[model samples]
Target: MAVRMLINGVAADQVPALDRGLAYGDGLFESIRLVDAVAPLWSRHMRRLVESCGRLRIPPPDTMQLWSEVLEVTRDMPHSVVRITVTRGIGERGYALPAAPQPMRVVAAFAPPQVADSAYAQGVRMRVCDIRLAEQPLLAGMKHLNRLEQVLARAEWSDPAIAEGVLCDSHGRVISATMANLFAVVDGMLLTPALDRCGVAGVARAEVLAACPQTQVGALTLDALLGASEVFLSSSVRGILPVRSLDKQDYPVGGTTRQLQQHWRDLGLRWSRADE
Candidate 1:
């Protein structure tokens, strides 16, 4: 089925070419999964989007109106990936904020790619990306429009066998993956990097931390990662994916990892069913 898009409650085709989002990367976006006509993590995504807009000084659209637009765009789609983007609207040719700012909101729906359930069951292989994430505390956790870093890291490998890349911060401290948050089991405790310097605080990462309050968040070095008993990556789209190896250093999917995976699946199923 063809994807559908809406801009400010109108057909996406009506969007003006002068939209700032197309000219400059002055926007925030959310990639959410719509199951049974409901976006399970809609609230969480909206909260983060609003926070990102506040940080970027972009005026936020009304939440109720935005939700209405999302429903309008996805009304005919059952299971899909929903993308919501908000930009600073049309502006003069300058970096300065427009004298009278009007935000533009775009909501679109696309078929989500088919993922192998076994990948989550058996775990996935990962490589340590040589490309280090530059420390930008201001953009640390928001899903902003700038993503050249991830694009560069992902381009480093074309081998289909490798599923993801583990990234480190500019200071050589392990941060996360190109598209997900990293968690490891060290000394029988779950450890994830502190995202103060870099990395996105993924929705799945937040869920895992909420589910397991004892999970530790702190600075992690490559040495600690190499010596860890097990590792995994988390994202809203991928859920919890165990890391079978890092940079050819192998480790079995630990018991704790599996336990968390099961918990995550249960939560996901519940969320999906709740939308029914």
Candidate 2:
């Protein structure tokens, strides 16, 4: 490995031109946070990767081999982010699957995002995106390579003040942020948007639900979100981040959000202070 990246167990920076991931977006990816070169949620990520591969009809990579590759790429790095990408490999010019399929795996490591301490302490600002998510039950909840919806939603805002963008389904139900899962405390009960119809069911969201047993998953309206006493966004890389405001509606950084942040820290994941 070239200290940062590996392509199919080789030290390379590019994949074949006919790769299906680039040609048709036939792949899945996972972004894992590394603390002291260790991934605390490795098993959770691998479980999702295997399940998604089964759904996409692509052969899953061996978990042990992938972990070795992850270690090789992130060696000596105190804190970083590693992305694992698995694609259908090179294929012909059409949509048919290759008779003998060859899956491509790419593991790369880089410095973690520089999120300020205040983003976790004081909370971050968010905006409601105009782009609505289309419901697709078959493809829901997997971090597949095709992400044009999130691309358009994130493009709606370029202001440095906005930390994230909220995405809703066509029926006006809040689904998630452009890059994270949504959570709101409504009437003293923890609620998250149900992903049965659409939206990605993130690993961090699962962890939150596990730690906070009172959480309820169902349809969440934009009005309910604005009226909630607390709101937060969860991501594998960013961990748990409280939403201080959405558009003009403001929310306080409540106790539930603080408790979850401690839970994230206890798991050896740090988004705001990577050095510590």
Candidate 3:
């Protein structure tokens, strides 16, 4: 089967054109990886989604109802990706807010992408994107609807060999990968970029931080990243993917990266070849 979708608890494939999310990108979403028919980091995803809703002033959906809808759509699927979207329902002609706004809830499930076993066992190659992320403090760290930056950065490459792309902010500070969070092992210290200026704070990134409490979150420059002994990317869908090379720079799969992969398995979110 292909992708199954539901809109506002109904079996539908599309939303009305006037929906605020369609008109103005006014909404929040969470992409969760379901393994063995369960979402391992569901609570973390929910927390972020609720926080983002609060930030955007979009009334949060009922947690229980949302989960039920997710389960309903993903039922019988052993491995899949479930995306939950909450949008401000159909609105008036302008940017003005509706006095009694109704929120739309969408739950969809798709077959997970088939990643080669080698891509996980032996690190994957990446590239440095020419496009840079804009610094927006107001929208930083939240997975909001506007994603033109990521769309453009991802369009920079179409080569199948490059597993991901490293994206930096306007000031040359490394923020994250096109679809994941960035992390590096520098001189025995674990470091990840601070998302205050920009970037989505991924759920897998939070798991890494929790596993390694000593992780330093701060500004990470391109020089700092290239100089690191090990580099890895994390996302809710693909857990920890060590970077074998970025552009012409080479990186080893190293002990630190493997250890972190183990940490992910310990958290009961196992899908990587490293777990095998």
Candidate 4:
């Protein structure tokens, strides 16, 4: 399948040329995991979408209707990745908001990446990116359309062996990965960087926070991040992925990472070929 897509409830692959989303990157998006026509984390995606739309002053699409469209676009998929995007709609030149803008909604589904068994079994290699995240408290934690920072950071490397790139703020505080939230197991407590200043708050990260009793959120430095007994990255699509190495520093795939992986797997979420 050549990636099914829908634009404003219509079967299409293109959006308006003057769409505010295209022009100004004024939008919010969610990447959902669709299995057997059902999204395991649909609730979290919708909740985050609502919260993101509120943050951007854009109206949210109806959840029931959006669900229907998701099913329609991904009808034949056993396991797929669907992306839902909501933009502030078409606007003329200038950043000024239209008096009453009709939010543009785009829903699309595609085959997921062919994940290697070792990615979950042995774990993934990561690198620390030199591209530091700028502090923008207003845009922090929301999955907004603006992602030039991540694009640049991801461009810092091309080796497919490096599964992800760990990111830090301008002050050298560990924030997250290029596309996932990061967690470090220090001593015995679970520690994740607080996203109050920057970074995306991932759904899988939220689940871990709720599931782990000994969890703490704070501004973690790179030195403090690498001092952990174990490390892992979380994303709604990938679940929990154990970090085997950050550059040359190696971390063993420990029990805590596996426990969370099994937790999501028990929810019927597909991890990878390894999980099967």
Candidate 5:
């Protein structure tokens, strides 16, 4: 639990009570994986953060400054996770945003996933929750601070055996997993659900699409997901994770998953390593 948390480049314990991020969840966050004290996905995280800030109308922090803080807070750590949160600073009592809102940035570091390599090679089991994501076109792909949907969906099950939960839209179209982007291989084509209506567009998903130009993004149904030849989850920290089983049905960690994992490793995203 030896970690350092900084608020606006200085050591601090808490944010202002009137901060809009705490008041109305007016904020954005990026979880960066620091492998060997390096963040290979820093550019991707910065791109998404800038996009989210523009979408949310919050001012984006200086990319170089943010990187400096990332390294500053996570110094000397061999393997860790650095989470950067940008808030709309303190605001008035009403819903109206300030005309000149100053954004507050918080950087904190913690231990990375401790799951064994077997979890990635053999695949992890996930569950489908009853809670459906309400379509919000405006907030569709932004990783804003509001995560009550994922919180409640994750709360739907407490089985330690379940590594993650797949979420769908109100119309039963699969979107993504609770913490990672979902991907499936169907008819020898890589497919992932379109996130124009819901779900966060994870950084790792962006990388996969960039590397595998043949990948397609569209609506994915639960039946379609179950019918796929292979399934996996992508995230900044974990890289790629094959899905072994979805509830009662079983899926092997097929070649497609291995190929994508190898691609990530070749790209020098050290977090891609499934082994410690």
Candidate 6:
């Protein structure tokens, strides 16, 4: 079936070319998992989108209307991936913001890849990417459309055996995976690199923190991760995935990782059953 997309509350046959999101990557997006026609992490996704828009100086869209559109689009699907993209609307051929910019909202629903669910249970293999993330504090931690870093990182490996790539900042500090936030279990505590300087603060990472308050959030060096007892990564779309290997080091997906995964699964089930 052809996926449907809602653009500013109107059904669209195709995305417009003038969209700044496509032209200059001037936008933010949220990739959410829908279960039983409900987005399991809708609130967290919305919160991050709101904050990103504010930071980028883009006007916020109607949240209630947005949610309604999301539900409307995914109503028929048993399980799907919902993508919400908000752009700076159309503009003239320049970087100058339009005097009265009418921001574009795109809500799309499609069948999610089966790999998303299986990745959490079976875990995934990773490689150390050659592409390094440039530190951009202004754009840090927002899922904005500028993804060249990840694209380059992902391009490093063509082997299907590799599931994801672990990225490091220019200074060689481990930032995250190509599409997820990373967490390493060390000394009996959860350790994830602080995204204050680089990388996206994933919704799944936030949920994990909420579930386990004692998990530490701070700067993490590659050496620290290499010496850790276990490692895992998180994303809103993929939930939690244990890292089976990184570079030459390998770690088993242990009890703590399984416990957190279970917690996330329970939360997803609860959210799916909640009143829409």
Instruction: Report RMSD (Å) for each prediction in the order shown.
Output: 2.8, 1.7, 1.3, 1.0, 1.4, 3.1
**Tens-digit per-residue lDDT, 151-215, candidate 4:** 99999999999989999999999999999999998878789999999999987788888889678
- Each prediction's Cα lDDT score? 0.81, 0.92, 0.89, 0.90, 0.89, 0.84
Rank by lDDT, descending? 2, 4, 5, 3, 6, 1
What lDDT score is found at residue 10 in candidate 2?
83
Using TM-score as the measure, name the better of candidate 3 and candidate 6: 3
TM per prediction: 0.91, 0.97, 0.97, 0.98, 0.97, 0.93
Residue-wise lDDT of candidate 2 within 230-265, one digit each (tens)? 999899999899999999999999999999988888
Q: Write the per-residue lDDT of candidate 3 for residues 1-276, one digit (tens) a residue.
A: 687888999999989999999899999899999877778799999999999989988899998998888888888987889989899888898998888989999999998877777877788999989999998899999998899989999999899999899999999999999999989999889999999979999998998898889999999999989999999989899888889998998998988788877777776666755454
For the record, the alpha-carbon RMSD of candidate 2 to the native fold, in angstroms, is 1.7
Clashes of each: 0, 0, 0, 0, 0, 0
Q: Could you tell me the TM-score of candidate 5?
A: 0.97
Global lDDT of model 3 = 0.89
Ten-residue region with minimum lDDT total, candidate 1? 267-276
lDDT for model 5 comes to 0.89
| Deviation from native of the Cα of residue 215 in model 6, angstroms | 1.6
Residue runs of model 2 more than 4 Å from their true location after superposition: 1-3
lDDT of 4 at 171: 91
Which residue pairs in model 2 clash with each other? none
lDDT for 125 in candidate 6 is 83
Identify the leading candidate in terms of lDDT. 2
Q: What local lDDT score does residue 260 receive in model 1, on the 0 to 100 scale?
A: 72
Q: What is the lDDT of residue 193 in candidate 6?
A: 86
